[model samples]
Target: MKEISTLRLAKELERSERTIFTVKELTSQIKDLLENRFLLVWVEGEISQLKNHDSGHIFFSLKDEEALLKVIMFRERARELPFPLREGLQVLCFGRISVYPPRGEYRLIVQRIEPRGLGSLQLAFEALKRELAARGYFDEARKKSLPAYPERVAVVTSISGAALHDFLRVARERWQAEILIYPVRVQGEGAAEDIARAIDNLNRMKDLDLIVITRGGGSLEDLWAFNERIVAEAVFRSRIPVVSAVGHEVDYTICDFVADLRAPTPTAAAQQIFPDRKQLIEDLDFRRRRLFELISERLRKLERELHHLSKRLKSPEKLIQETGERVQDLEARLRKALAHQFFLKENRFRNLVRHLEAVSPLAVLSRGYSVTRKLPEKIVIRKAREVRTGEFVEILLEEGRLEARVERIHPDNHLF
Candidate 1:
């Protein structure tokens, strides 16, 4: 019965009219369908599992809460991105869907990409900020300090703009400095290069104390020149201190972070770099008064000390008389000390003389004792055997020395 059932199922399968397809054939059809259907479509989703390949291609998953799609950007398209693509970043991609035949999977072939909420300019700004920070371009240690009193300032801005006028007015009100207006476009094409060149030129000048890169407040698009990497690099490389006054207080740019100082506005920049002449004069006057007070107090203190010293001081004549009395006392004491020292020296001399006389050989010779020494050698004979027979000898008597011949050396026993 099982064989009959198998036979009947095989016959039914052969009779049925159904199309059969290989995996490759089916995948090719799907690839064509997806590529045609999704041509030039836009997709918005959060990025995930991002992979930046060494070949400059980027691969990632685009995911919404409900579904996930595989995405790919080739080297050429990826290179055009102003910012790096990262995981979890929401992005809008324009591409066509295509299927991989081997894996039987469909993915987006992205031709263009952008951050979801941020414009290209803002994306570029953030990207550059991170890069420059990593390069230490915004380090506090590298930023120069503004001079206390700037002697010469070079302003890089458009002369026709209100920013230049505002800066000049504030500068004139504050301090008298040499204002060198290096006019350059503050926005639009070629503005960043122009500003960078102006900075470099100002740095080459001999006596420029500060360089102010300023512009009137505007939208981010209108103020993009200051946000450029060229401007930031110029500000970083400048030998003279840089003041970035690009916009209103709320606006910020790359130049602001890299500059030595950031001022809210052009007018505020001038106020910051220049001293207030009126305030300085007031301060000098106050210091002069304080100095005068200090001098007067010091003189008073010295005068009081002098008066106290004068009261304790004796007259010259009285001082001389007392000095003479002291000299007389010192002279008497010196004479008494000298007499005592002489007496002690004389007693010491007498004792030394008596002791020397007791040990003198002349004293022994005068008491009938003689000293005999061999001639030529002059060796004193301590024993009778010390003298050689027939040798010449010197005999020291009480009054004089005599030369004699030694006839014999007597035995010591015979002498006893």
Candidate 2:
């Protein structure tokens, strides 16, 4: 009975050894079962231990109150997320279960993720808008003014879009200008990057006066490229003035806020940048007419003043003839006055000569009187005492003079 029992135990041991497996083989079997069973699934959890690698891969753990699951997003999937991932954020993830054979671990290979309540795209838009506002990207002072008359313009848009056609039509109607098309993708993956690169490239050219970034209306997802921070930064950094004409009037994007000017539509953007050609021509014509009117009025005023002056002016020949007649009259009057004056002067001269003769001693001498004076001194002798005895004396007449010696001196009775 003991020998039979030992042989039965040996058979049981051999069967058990045949079914046993190594650690790698057992893990591989578990991996195959989990992967096949959970090919695609939706897991809701709060993110934790989030690690974003420089290689563009994201590693994290999704945990709830009682359980936690390891998760990873490769670079290709990670870049598709519009909003940034943070710790403790409640998210819904769609992915397949994957096993790391080397570590004997299972994790979720996330294909897509979304925030629990608000849409991820909307959340991203709001978050980026706030960040850019804080950095002064939306400051009115920093915005450049669009040219009143844009001579050269560069448009960034898809060639096939209706936005380009609308803009071209409006611009052509309003003004004559050089339009440069800088074609780029308006929506889809890498659209934002493509737009930004186009903006940067257009800025390199020296001749562009303005940049117009335009696209037709679409859903939020379709219009998302304009809301990207990359595109906003490109608009902000541009030296050339930028106009954002991205959608219908109701839809607003980050690019609209950051651009120098925002238009309701592509047509409106063209209208704002270019002046009306016909109106400008009319204005120039009006100014020209006004200038001519002013010149005519000035000439007419000067002609009237010249006419008034001519009326006051005298003929030179007539003035000279009048002056000669007056001179002749003055000469005749002067001669008559001189003759009357000379006759009066001659009568006065004769009366003066008679008065001088009445008082002249020479006339008295001519009437037989003489004047005697002491000799040598020739002093007049008014009385006999003026001469001394034995002194020579002289006598004067009108025409002759005599000299004699005084024999004696005498005194008159009136002197006693």
Candidate 3:
């Protein structure tokens, strides 16, 4: 059917009376014309419907108050979008127009998409900030604390950048510290990766007390490397505290949120990390003077006490007499105490002897009580049940032991 139609159209055109085209030929021509003419165009509209395919293609409708246009974005272009596209979002789409022959439809093939009211970079920054914030990257509790006095510090930044010079000048002047500069690209391609790697390497060293990731003031694009997720993650994972001093005072980045300290500028970062030597010296001197005064006051108090004590002192002869009297009195008291203690001990010993006699079996035997034991075993028989008939038993008295044979066995419950 297609061939027949092509032939008919060709015959019609050859007659010179009219020009005709088959459906496929016409659609092809339209596709070519639209693609070539509108190679690049920008369209602004509110997204009404969006569909994402498994093939990573996006199909959506862009509609305004007056018109609606179908849009399609392929995988390569769609992946570059920093923020998600959704229905009811107003956006500016940049792409070319193309026609599909099978469906006989024309749609815009988008290469880029940006939120209508904001720049692409700004929108991207905001999107990333929200994502990382949700993951606790920007939490204050998660941020590390900077060193009070850093002996060794690392500055991860472009060696040639002005930030390094400013930081070093202020740091050197304020305090004595070991400064280690790790050179890296501050911006442009691969800058984020370089900064992250430097941070990881410095952390591995374990000698640095503080790390300062800094860059000079520049446009948003120029400062974007510091805002990357890789740099933010590196700063978050660092064992040593990190100080972020990127761009000017008004500038802020993801690194600033994730760092232990955020400095408005590179010079400020230095000031925070290093203490002023002159101030410290003055403080130490003041403390020393105060300590000296305190010691002098304590000594004067001791002298006063000594003087008071000396005034209470007596003549040597009188002191000796008084001491002799005290010794005599103590000796008298000691004699009396010894006699009293001896009397108490004598009474205690007599009482102990009485208690011992109360429990002594010999004393009981002397009182006419007898103890009996089975012969040969020598075990004291407390009950008649313990001795059987015809068993020889020994009787213990205060004077002598007598042996006898048990004639019968009997148990005395009342005696027990």
Candidate 4:
């Protein structure tokens, strides 16, 4: 009876095969049936045989211990992956079935792929954080130091948020710095970009000493702007020192790591950056009082010293007597100096006079020598021939001048 049934089924199969469809038609029909039956289905499996093509399409196989399903995510859909795809990674995929007519194979057309244990956004955040950290963006060495006293502070936050109000309230009471608000979206789409742009714009102002980036506490999705790479990079590149005050004290974000300073809250940032005016006044008063006391003490000490010195001092008459005695002693020294100088000058003068007397011609004349000169010519008779036998000559002697005639001219040829 089973063989007779099998034969009847075979004849029915042969009849259906006589009107068989082409490969394309068959694949299209199967694709349509499977896609329609499993539209927008969730599939959880481990990825295997993954291939990321140059065209940005990802082709892989999702498998389990029992079976495997071929998956293909096109470029447009694959671009939305928050994390990198790899073989043997367990994932949850949402897509519909699709067929390749040429290959006659049906594949799961994936729209989105997420890691099994973590949310997509969280995975993206971690991925971006790792990338930035590897590039030294989160290095503490790159961070700038905040000004000791910032006079102009720029607050980048949502104008409608309570953060601004809290910051302003604390700032106004604490310090006299001018607050400039750069209003931007703190949540939702484009919030990260808005924050980055605001930071860049605030940096263009040379007068801005501090940039405080802040937002109120919220869910991870709402606080994602502070975690974005755009905002982190902006904080890192800012010329002015940046202060990140986002969410509550327990919260942390990428901006907090890259910023020059990280405050727990907006109010905390205000208090940390600004000095308390009352405390400053009190400190100034304390220092001023200290300085005045020191000066007064010094003056009092000087007065005491003066009094002590005055007590040890002599009377005016005694002072005058001492001064007079000093003057008399100085006068005696002056007279002694003058007498010594006069004795030295007298010796020098006497030596000069003796030298002059030794060189004088009258000294030679005193030794019985005379100077004779021919009369009328007044030439000195140095040679006998200088005077004729009858020429009158004058003889210069030590006592007087004598006039005489040349009586004899003795020829001294033999002596020459």
Candidate 4: give the clashing pairs: none
lDDT of 1 at 129: 86
lDDT string, candidate 4, 1-416, tens digits? 23568878789887845767887787788888887888888898988999999999999999999989999999987764545676667788988877777887777889877566536456666776787788898888988888878899999999999999999999999888889999999997678879999999998898789999999998777787787766887888898999999999998888888888899999999999998999999999999999999999999999999999999999999999999999999999999999999999999999999999998989999999999999988998888987789999999999999999989888686655
Query: What lDDT tens digits, residue by residue, belong to model 3 across residues 96-213?
Result: 9989899999999998776665365676677778887888988888777777888999999988989999999999999999999999999876788799999999988967798899
- Please, what is the TM-score per model? 0.64, 0.55, 0.58, 0.62
Q: In model 3, which runs have C-alpha deviations exceeding 4 angstroms?
A: 1-118, 313-320, 330-416
lDDT of candidate 1 over 158-220, digit per residue (tens) = 989999999999899999999999999887767887999999988889988889999999988
Q: Candidate 2 — what's its lDDT?
A: 0.90
Model 2: per-residue Cα lDDT at residue 212: 97
Listed per model in order, the count of residue pairs whose N, CA or C atoms clash below 3 Å is: 0, 0, 0, 0
For candidate 2, lDDT tens digit of each residue in 239-296? 9999999999998999999999999999999989899999899999999999999999
Model 3 scores worst on lDDT over the 10 consecutive residues at 114-123
Model 2 TM-score, 2 decimals: 0.55
Clashing pairs for predicted structure model 1, backbone only: none
The alpha-carbon lDDT assigned to residue 274 of candidate 3 equals 93
Q: What stretches of model 1 exceed 4 Å from their correct place?
A: 1-118, 351-416
